[model samples]
Target: MINHGKELFSAIVPTEQKGLKRKIYVITKAFIKL
Candidate 1:
């Protein structure tokens, strides 16, 4: 059970990180355009 939980966590973290990075990129781009 612990190993399965760790696998799920590893999978989720990268996707969330990618989403956050994209959001930051978009915000930065908008700020630059302003």
Candidate 2:
């Protein structure tokens, strides 16, 4: 059970990171446009 939980946590982390990266990219693009 502990290993399964760890796997799930690890899986979630990358998705969150990707979302964060996308947000940063959008912000940067907006700034460039301005």
Candidate 1 lDDT over 1-34, as tens digits, reads 6775565556556657678776556556545655
> Which RMSD values do the candidates have, in order?
12.6, 12.7
Candidate 1 clash pair list:
none
TM agreement with the true structure for every prediction: 0.46, 0.46
Give all candidates' CA lDDT scores: 0.60, 0.60
> Model 1, stretches more than 4 Å misplaced?
1-18
The pairs that clash in candidate 2 are none
- Per-residue lDDT, model 1, residue 29, is 58
